[model samples]
Target: MERDFYTFCTAMKTLDIGSAEGRGMSPQNYATIRLALAACYGKLSKGRVGSSLELTSEQEEHRERKGRHYCGLKEKGKRKDHERICIPGVAAAALSAVVFARMRHSSLEVLLCGLSLFDVLVLSSTLLIYPAMNACQNEPDPTNSRVCHFFWRSTLIAYPLSLIAQAGSVWTCVAITFDRFIAVFFPIKKRVWATPHTSTYIICGVAFFSVLFKLPAFFEITLNEYGQITPSSLRLDATYQLVYMTYMYLIFILLIPWTVIIVLNGIVIQKVREAYRTHKRLTQRNTRGRRDTDERKMTVMTIVMTGIFVLCNIPPAINNIIESYAPQYRDRYRHRIPLSTLLVCVNSASNILIYCWFNRQFRRSVFRLCSSAAYKRRASEYIRASKEASMSQTLKNKL
Candidate 1:
């Protein structure tokens, strides 16, 4: 489809990811989009050999800001290979841990150990890696600029790793919801139908499906002929490869799952409130008292977790809307601007904090990990051998 000019400009001016937000793009005003992109996205249109080429859209606009990922544009120096590796490592680690946690087939109570480990790994990696990241500066070292160096060799690999991990989470959550629904609506067969064996099977099916769903993304990113890591420039004819993937991400993955989560969570919340109110009424009818704090805790937790899911998803959802319907806005804002890229990065990174705040089970697991027997033993050894540190320095003192 060709571009629409007016809608694009309107979308650009209003979006938070635009010039009005104090985002940086060099040469703040430009006569053309190409000039603005070179100034803002750190690409010099003047490279001698490996110069990055700019694409023009008849409807395209350029702005002076930070997040515009005018891909492949680089300042005249070599790609600063070492500067951006940290994001990928953190991604990989989180993904691996998530897979480990969802490996349960039976005996959930015992398997909860694995789940706890997985959650802790994901939470810790996601949170820690961000602050650890070095600012993306252009390094003269070509070797450091390699994609492998950017993710694994430089800092961590748990961030991109999270794309798959999130798919796993969505699958697991859907499975859990399905499990709850079956028990709630089919109470008579609860013990028989919702047995550990059945839950195990459900988990397995969801895991396989989630993995299959995410395979495309993993494959789409690869090392190109130039020894440079490049994201998929999906062929024009490969509808399923590029455009289809984009829509799938917008509709099935982010949009559909979020919609289901909201509706189901709304129902669950309504039921919980009704159950609580009914309990209070019946108690007054019989004994003149309501349930205590523990019941209230469950109520509060249900609301908290539900809110987390929605809050964690908002950015990417916004991105999808912009990418799908607001292309002209994307164009006019210009690749020279940085607002768009920052929003996308934020979308990618927010999940770390989500589990930390809402998933009580996850937080508790992290606490347990810190206080684990192995940790305690190692901590004691450190204390016994050291003269500068003491009893007050242990994690227990803080957590």
Candidate 2:
């Protein structure tokens, strides 16, 4: 069968070329189609083709169907894993935000609150919107269903929102690191600069700029009249891919943040160690020593957060670079993409655990918050019981 198909392809290349030229088709178009046909033939004969020629419509559709089947079988476990992690991660992030907001102990809590909220946005989008979009796309007639239409439009909106949220999360980490850096290196200046108001302003600025920067992503995918999700022409531009997707993302999102976090974290860690050593030498258990210990713990927490951010994000960064420069190998590394996304989900979700583990104050606050809620519930129940007993006594006297 393969030999017969190859022979037919050869005949078309030789005979159809002349007929195609006579039928007023341009030589370039004819050549492109011929190359596509050759690639298809090679696939059947050799089990692989490396031509990179633009596939004909039928071939493209076939490839997409095959890829979908491959993913369904291979990615079932990954989808399950995503569900396991993201649901709890969203809850944890929300809990962390509430706890941090109630604390109001320092500017760091404000930054942490912002981080937690942004992480909620990230994890929620990943959990709900993207998965919904994927399920809608898998339908036979996605356009015919109102639910699919809603999710299709939601996905376009969600794409930019997710990017904005992710950017906000990244810059919030940067802000937290910078705050620690200032507290350690410029203790006298920290009072002037690292106020809650300053932190709020920084959070607002980061949010505004993140939206502005990711606004283009809104157009990256669009629903066509037929309700099929398609990449916009802007997404297909080679210059845009190279300049915006490759260079700009690498520089702004990965390189700059990574450099700032790593360098500042190292210096802050060293300063913290020096302070600890000095306190030990003094052999003082005074309020000053306690303050130093709290500061050191905060610094350690900041370092751990930044370290996790760097580690979790590294795979995605590498994957992005690979897709940008060596796209031919994308299929080979497709499994890694889901793993990278899992790492990001874990990073966003794991901050609460980090806080609980490293910060004694955070754990105490969480315990107090839970206990307070429980106390209120119990008080309400007692009041209701007392009111019912008084009503019964009144009713018995009337009888």
Query: In TM-score terms, which candidate is top?
Result: 2
Q: TM-scores of the models, in the given order?
A: 0.53, 0.76
lDDT of 1 at 376: 86
- What are the lDDT figures for the candidates, one per model? 0.45, 0.78
Worst 10 residues of 2 by lDDT: 69-78
As a TM-score, model 2 comes out at 0.76
lDDT top scorer = 2
Score residue 338 of candidate 2 by CA lDDT: 69
Tens digits of per-residue lDDT for model 2 on 1-399?
544544445444333323344446887886776666545434442345653246677876566444434333222233467778889999999989999988877889999999999999988877766466445544444446665677767777767787889889889999999999999999889989998889989999999989888888987897665664667999998998999989989888988988888988988888888987887789648897788788888889889888988999899888998899998666556558768878888999999999999889889988898899999999999999999999999999999
Off by over 4 Å in 1: 1-136, 141-160, 182-188, 233-238, 241-243, 282-303, 331-375, 378-399
The alpha-carbon lDDT assigned to residue 336 of candidate 1 equals: 23
What is the per-residue lDDT of model 1 for residues 1-399, given as tens digits with 9 covering 90 to 100?
013323333333222122221224443342244343343343333432123334344212332122133332333334222224325434533543453255433233212222233343344444433332322233323334543245332232454454555665554545444444444456467567666676656656655666677665554554544333344554223576446557777766777777777676677667667667766666334222322333334334434543554565565556656656677565544442333323333433343344445445555655565468578899888878774465446755887
